[model samples]
Target: MIAQLARKIRYIADPAFDTRDGYGGKLVIALRDGTFIERTEPYHWGSPELPISAHDIYDKFEANTAASHLVGNVGKIISMIAALEDVGRVGDIVELCRREQD
Candidate 1:
């Protein structure tokens, strides 16, 4: 699977991206219609100026864990984390994340 995927992937360097202050990048998706979807990102994100919303954070978590055995605990974990100051023990969160024994 990896070998087949590697053959179709191409890596290239573009002089446009600069890293004086931080890493910069441009993402372009080439479509068959001779058009490209492009986005210019000046640098890495998640700073105070580029804060990630709580909704986006939960969406990412849900997308990654949708197929895992721990799917049942996602809701509870998010709730506990949101009100972390009221949580008596961090162990409660850890227990919900325990891996199923193979």
Candidate 2:
């Protein structure tokens, strides 16, 4: 339920701005068979939902009209997650998720 709501929120918020790729740029996905695949590129980032919470409470709607804005630094966030993965650091990942909740 939360994921569905978040996807609707994201689509309504930014129809043009897709989710991030694993490494850097936003992910462009193929929706089929109730599954999505990342259409990768040379500078691909991770799939969108992978980096964010199952629910995106980001105030995208309110921020849309602002002249200047700051996007959540997802690449850095993913890097931290990757570092945790590389070191077999599950506890750190949990802590990171907790911080994100705050």
Q: What's the number of clashes in each of the models?
A: 0, 10
Tens-place lDDT digits, model 1, residues 58-79: 8888889999977999999889
Q: List the residue pairs that clash in candidate 1.
A: none
lDDT of 2: 0.43
TM-score for every candidate vs. truth? 0.72, 0.22
Predicted structure 2: clash tally:
10
Candidate 2 local lDDT, 19-92, one digit each (tens): 34234334445455677665433333225534444224233422542342222444333565546557465665
> Which candidate comes out best when scored by lDDT?
1
Judging by TM-score against the true structure, name the best candidate: 1
lDDT at residue 50 of model 1 (Cα atoms)? 64
Give the lowest summed-lDDT range of ten residues in model 1: 16-25
Q: What TM-score number comes out for model 1?
A: 0.72
